[model samples]
Target: MTLTAVMSAPPVTVAPDVPLSEAARLMAEADVGCLPVVAADGSLLGVVTDRDLTVRWLASGADPSAEVAAVMSAPAVTVRADHTVDHAYRLFRRTGVRRLPVVRGGRPVGMLSVDDLLIDALRRFADLLGPVSGSILHDDTEQGFRSPGPRTVDTNGPESPVVGDVMSRALVAVGADASFQEVTDLLQHWRTGSVPVLSGDGRVVGVVSEADLLRAQDERAAEDPARLTARRLMTAPAVTVHPDTAPSDAARLIVDRGLRRLPVIDTEDRLVGSVHRGDLLAAAGRHATDLADRVRFALLAAVHPDAFSQLSVRADDGLVVLDGRLPRGIGADEVAHLIRSVPGVREVDVTARPSGPAEVHGDS
Candidate 1:
């Protein structure tokens, strides 16, 4: 689906010349986390997020009354309204930015926040669950409902879930110079299996897993060991995933390489989050739900409402069944083709009836 279908429109904007305090006030009033910094002609100049205000301005002891331009993130990252939601998601992962201005002919038309994508996804999930759950209730078989979609091993496919969707955002990192005890404390406190060992530049240089700590302890007991630090204990040259990495691919790397966690990094190679094997498994498990949602939402957005207002759709085990009346000149094959384009729908079964009929077409 195109970003226009999910992006929040009539975006709240701020002038680059506005006071930082006024910008913050605007964000509070609109209950938004960021504001597009636009020119007088509505050209997006930059973006100012709450984090920017806190980290770049307040933390730096900059004057609150200064122009927001002083603190705003420049060279705005953006996506065209016509871009696919998948494309926008890729941009989000690459930039590590939470909001992207949706533009049309160089003018800001809307904002696509992570929240917007999440809500859209949830609504689609609801549509998927409604019919599937209803059908499950009517069936007497012991078989459980399975979603139709490509599984995790097929990450190269068009519908693979991105790392941003499954990665753990509650980041816990240890500096390369941090003492072994400090690293242990952080791991214990976060209850995470591993921690990214970060260089002075804030880039992940290695990883310290439970195994690494145990190995270090063994070595320490074997002899009088040197002062242990993250740099010393961590396994170097970490295997990492970009935020846009496909879950299947990430899972393969984890399983094949015997990694406990995969650090998520941006284009700049800075640590953003981490994805563990369990996280990838969870994403793999949700494949059907994700595909069902994608198919339902995409078809609903593309189908002719005049002909299919009363149409109903349900997905089961990669098969899509449609029950509805078709308008004159519209064919079920055409509708089925549209549904087939969705990533996970294995087969499209459209029970189409003629315009005026109360009877069903195709299979019962």
Candidate 2:
């Protein structure tokens, strides 16, 4: 479907000349995390988000009366109103930005966000699965099947890459007593949205994000900003994941919690590394490619050299397709089963035909 069908239309906008305080007020009143900075002609010039306000203005203790253009992210990545949802997904993966401005003739008309795409995807899944689930339950009842208790499914097989495989091991963390400037400096130097606040024993106690710093600046107006510390400005009980966690689960947690990054912790809740949405997305693509290679290798090992040479394998988003000629002893079902044994393959499709006498033997 096109973006127009799913995008939020008539987006709230702010002028480039608007003061940072005014922009913040508009964001609060509109209940949005970002606002498009538009020119007088309605053309999108840039986008200013809560992160920008916090990290650029509040963290720097810049004048609130300063223009938003000074802090807005410019040359904004955008999507055309007529673009397909698939196109938008690619843009999201490529740009690593959660929101995109929808434009028409260089004029801002709407906004598209990851949340919109996620909701649409969930709705589509419901539409597709609801009837199937009902039929399944009906068949079970008619067959005199009994309920099965909850069971644990192990998703972290050797083939499935865990968070640790993709997480950035180079961590930039701060202690609870770190000065506010130190935290801001670390954020700027690392170019990260948030920093994990560690306890005395090196366990994550909280997270100091741009939002947290912004709140501290806003609420503690009279206090000296230099005296502020991570403990005074952090959000407690940080949402963390372990290294063994599946990348998919980590991605889900990030989306569900509206988090930009997740701190990876050890069994003892000690900070180990970090993972971002972009890392998870890249890992998915890499996993698909790796699965395809494994599938090819499996075919090579199971089938005759000639037949394997003729076979073609393709994998996309965990679905594997195999096409070619199968030897007399091997059936399509057998080939499919072999492919399915590969750990990362979710589904397998085989279109290989039985080889004829001449094809199987080196006969003319």
Candidate 3:
């Protein structure tokens, strides 16, 4: 798609000599996170965002009334309006600019945000098809789905168990306003990758993943890190499952769809727990022979399933490696309680995936 098709037209700007306090007021008045700083000749000199003002100036106790030329961040990131959306995507990620100024003959003509691309993605997936006609989710006989056999939830030990027995009642969802990085934050925060995107009407739009954000991050770094934003990074036309979906069926959906996590929504399409590939792995009592991978995946599945909780439970070695997702958005304490409760379990290894860093949501 062409950027002109979606770029916000005729962005506002301020002169380089404008007082920093005035620039702050302009941001507040215009309800924009960043503003273009222009020269007398209409050439772009610098750009300013809430972060620049707060982090580089305010936090440092710089004079608020200083001219923007003194505190504004430059050189500004810009793109041609005639370019394709892909060009804008490249520009944003490469420059690490949330809002890119569209230039024509060195003058700002329009603006495009990472949110614009994000909104377009959600619009594309608006009203996700659950059992839509000929939908992928409706297909049966898709292998790897195992029937839930009776497992010992309670071994007459103090701990009681099973995935269905204890998932959270609340789930945080992403909106069009949310960027790809924000989804990573949500997943890393919730300790699970892949979060459902909700429309204004509360309909499920799409899902975002670390892979999506990682691709964006890589793409941005591929060009310039300062330019890319979440909108340019998300994958659209997401598939989802209902919360009451059988763990086995959900696992099948994850496998069949080649997905890392599936959004579990109610009839109203509100988000519930994330059914990750590892979640299913734990439910089936399957563990990777790569001993450490198994124990941690199991413990997380038992304790904090919200965060991309995967326990690589090595029933033989009793060594467990715990990797917690929810990067910048969440920090989870080790489930010392759940760790001690596991039968024949020995060591616990914990690695928390922080924001901006990639976390593997599904098992290899």
Candidate 4:
């Protein structure tokens, strides 16, 4: 789905000739980020946000009563209503942007933001499945489920599980010293929606989402439309959740509280992991894929006595290749075919060496 599918009708806007202070006042009253400045005929001129006014114009001693056209971001990033969700993600990542002016016939129809993209991605998937399904289900942490998609369920029900269970331990974070530009680079590199803002001691200090940075820039435009700062722009008191909490509870906390992300905590309140709206829905996919993997293992075991016993599997860009020994009752070709049935297995290469007690070579 694109912004057109989920976007609201034309957002409120302002004229370039308006005073900087007046624009800021309107934004505060309306509670909006970046406004698209338009011409008399309704043609787009430039854009401004609270960040621009505060940092650029006001903080720098520029007259707030001055025309907004003096400091608005021009030729705004725009998207059509029919653009797909993936398209929005790509653009946001590419431009390090938070919002896009939706245009129809060259006229601003709506505004789209990374937050909207995140919410849409999750909400669309939410309709298909829940964190634990109709009811909470526990899963085997030691074993992989048939292979689930982004939402792999290690457990079935809403029982209090260990933090190590559902939490994605591999968290991507950034330093406060990192520039706004670099933050976008890191998030895009990881294809993540948000990254934890960490201090030197690894303490969770804040968070900077695509929306945050964009909003910051817009605020700057409203002010002087030039300066930037990470400290001033980040969202502090980061949202969090305990690792052992039930997925259902996490979902409730997020949905009811209007949160897009939650930092997963542990018994001691250390930042152990994170759980997002997408994570819950992804658990279901993981469950389905896990089931598929299980069947694959079973079939391989039944097909060849040592199908899995003697071989080591290696992955290269999502392709599974088998290496090592060709154990008793197992043929190299047969092993390849057997292992290929694994759910995530794409292509396989078999290079099996016949088993032997021992071999020694290269003597001085």
TM-score of each: 0.41, 0.62, 0.39, 0.49
Writing each residue's lDDT as its tens digit, candidate 3 over 237-303 gives 4566654454445554554455656655555665656555545555443323344443444443432
By TM-score, the candidates rank as: 2, 4, 1, 3
lDDT for residue 71 in candidate 4, whole number 0-100: 84
lDDT of 4: 0.58
| Deviation from native of the Cα of residue 144 in model 1, angstroms | 38
Ranking by lDDT: 2, 1, 4, 3
Highest TM-score: which candidate?
2
Q: What lDDT score belongs to each candidate, Candidate 1 first? A: 0.65, 0.71, 0.54, 0.58
The C-alpha stretches of model 3 lying farther than 4 A from their native spots are 129-364
* Ten residues in sequence with the least summed lDDT for candidate 3: 126-135
Clashes of 4: 51
Which regions of candidate 1 fall more than 4 Å away from where they truly are? 127-364
**Per-residue lDDT tens digits of candidate 1, residues 261-295?**
77887766688888765565445445545565555
Q: lDDT of model 2 at residue 262?
A: 79
In model 4, the Cα lDDT at residue 239 comes to: 55
lDDT of 3 at 116: 64
Q: lDDT per residue, candidate 2, 1-364, as tens digits?
A: 5778888888999999999888877776665677999999888888998778867886687888899989999888888887656566656756789889888888888988876665444332232111221111111343332211112335583455667888999878999999888888888888777899999999888898866665565555667766688998888777787776666666665666667787888867788899876576545544543677667545533432234556678889889988876654467888899889877889988887777542221101
Per-residue lDDT value at 184 in model 2: 81
* TM-score, candidate number 3: 0.39
